[model samples]
Target: MSDAATKSDAAMKPGWTPRSAWAGILSEGSFGAKGPAGVTATAREDLGIASLIAPEDGEAALSQVVKTRFGLDLPTTPRTVVLAGRALVWAGPGQWLLVTENRTGFASDLQALSGLAAIADQSDGRAVLTLSGGKIRTALAKGCMIDLHPSAFPVGSAALTSIAHIGVHLWRADNGPNGAVFEFMVARSMAGSFWSWFSASAAEFGYSVHVGRG
Candidate 1:
């Protein structure tokens, strides 16, 4: 192989281990495991997050651009939709958040598109946590005031809400045999606090904490 190819391969090699914001608090111990029904919350760091802001008059055009680039349309309502390897989450009237697992450099790619959209990388600015199990909704109800009934916030629904006064971008990512799996994206600074609140609220129902990459 050429020297340039060899150097490129070397540069792409994995390096030192990186730590997530929640690394300090997440432990691999059983906290709520004695109950009949239990919840499992996992903290992951492998998700890429990006915020998209479109111009007042550029919503339609930007939506098209997103569709053309990601093979997914921007969700117009408060919902989450996934296509290929990415998810488009409605954040506001004209704004959306882009998320992907194992997809890096997305923010830069989004920014590169010439349009009325403003793209910002939030992969490091936010922490993602996934909650699953039969009692997931019940546990979240302790602090979150949203109606999370299967009929209300059904799978693929996304909402900008608050839990214990901390703002959170929440969505029902999956629902099947394992029950509902809710994903929470919170400010990195509030990750520890959010986890604390979630754990405490889930204690009565019996829960397990799993920490890993997205």
Candidate 2:
């Protein structure tokens, strides 16, 4: 007997369609020991994302345009402002990531503000997932380095950090009946890697998964 096999037989193979890379591995159901669910994960594949870059020394002008257009005061720090189903999330100095369901509408609004800031669609390059429930914070803590304590990363808080070496933008949304709410924004290429770490982290408390229709 030899370890090598003849070419006639193929070893077990793993594959994914160009767009549905994570689909084969994830099922829409609960995993781990069953009990009262401590976490729920939902895909936000339809989300329209874009980067808003303020022109040099045009911060004030950018603020005015965003204010008049979306009735939003651009977040100057790491925070999230939700208005009319859209979130203006601060990414860094004079930069923000806009998340919404209607990308065309959002792009139009950005056009109204483009005179002061640069707008680029980020939808295709980003992967977003909404995570919620009682044990979210604890599960997140397993791989995230930041302090998730309410007093530290309270609701509306957002940050660009890493999980298992994968870069991610983590943010805390309003609390839900189950408990806290949060979302992760990661590069499309690393989504599978990120989820692997997340699923394991969440398994201890029990969790559910929902793949988006998109």
Candidate 3:
């Protein structure tokens, strides 16, 4: 181990191991997995409180809103949903999805808009994390209380579930290679505890932890 690795290991709490490989990736983005070329990974984070509630028109409404507010024309069949600078995917019914970016500027847009929708700022209520690697599914199985096998969950699908007793927004990534990357969104208060639980479960798989911007 390098000097820094040695020191990190020494300072780590019991049952915890420091991961160095992902240090750089975390610092670059909010949540998403870094992987070898052609491999897939899922990443997730909170979309600060810039909530947009559109009506049954679905993508049409979303496109119109994007054009009118941001002058951006959204794609019709976007596998990833982007709103207020945050990207999200559907987690369950009721037109709900998980946002994976910090909602820094979303509040103002929602406030000045009027349409067939509702908007709420939920920036303070959530936290996010990214999971990736060839063994991601195996790693997640350690704590997730769901049948997350590809046949069941499938790519491009998302679900609201629990991990270590905390509610999470779980989404499968579309570009995942070998089906191994995923993103998770959780409540802010549960961040530390969930990390602890996730790290513990990942130990046997040679898991490592990286703390930084991503």
Candidate 4:
């Protein structure tokens, strides 16, 4: 191999770590309207993310593989399910985004389904953020057209929506003591633009940001 290739490989080996998409954009701290913060956005880059796509002819088989491997069924519609610390969020007709915390070999594990479907590593291709607080819904309502009311987009609901013209895969992870905790998955390239819309929307009340280990 060329010297350049060898150096590039070594630089990104073991000790090397990926940087957060929110670096410089989101710092760990409280900001905005001063008083008690009404919203909090946590950058969850520590989470491992991957894309699962089933071939039209292999959808059924792939679902079985997933269930056997992860002990969870893939959602048929826009929804999310957590089983064994992993979240399978429906992305489309035959696609789901798998998310987990502290699972470094996430994508490799998903490879077990490769015989039935395609698995793409999205740990670096996507930016994951968890937004929650008393004003979380209101803040999300500013740009999300879909109704976020519990009666509609209840906990475990997932949707492929747009925020400020940017495409985002959103899911209601859980109902926190204060309110629903929502997670937003967006393309890495659009992270900055999304943050701008998010921060501005939550500024009316107050928001805090906690950067994660990306």
lDDT tens readout by residue for model 2, 1-214: 3556543244555554446435554678898758977889987766778899887899998888778877888999999998887889999999998888656576576667666778888887888888998898889989899898889989999999998999999899988788778888998889889989999999999999997643
User: Which predicted model would earn the best lDDT?
Assistant: 4
Model 2 global lDDT (CA atoms, 0 to 1): 0.83
Candidate 1 vs candidate 4: which has greater lDDT? 4
Give residue 124's error in model 1 in angstroms: 0.5
Tens-place lDDT digits, model 4, residues 62-94? 878778888989899999999877888999999
Error of 1 at 210 (Å): 1.4
Worst 10 residues of 4 by lDDT: 102-111
Candidate 3 error regions (>4 Å): 1-86, 98-105, 108-115, 176-179, 211-214
lDDT of 2 at 26: 66
lDDT (0-100) at residue 212 of candidate 3? Answer: 28
TM-score of 1: 0.86
* Global Cα lDDT for candidate 3: 0.55
CA lDDT of each candidate?
0.84, 0.83, 0.55, 0.85
- What is the C-alpha lDDT profile of model 3 across 96-160, one tens digit per residue? 44343554555655655446355555565555565666667777887897777878866656677
* Native-to-model Cα distance after best TM-score fit, residue 151 in candidate 1, in Å: 0.9
Query: What's the CA error at residue 52 for candidate 1, in Å?
Result: 0.4
> Which 10-residue span in candidate 3 carries the lowest summed lDDT?
37-46
Extract clashing residue pairs from model 4: none
lDDT (Cα, 0-100) at 203 in candidate 3: 52
* Candidate 4 off by > 4 Å: 1-17, 212-214
lDDT of 1 at 203: 87
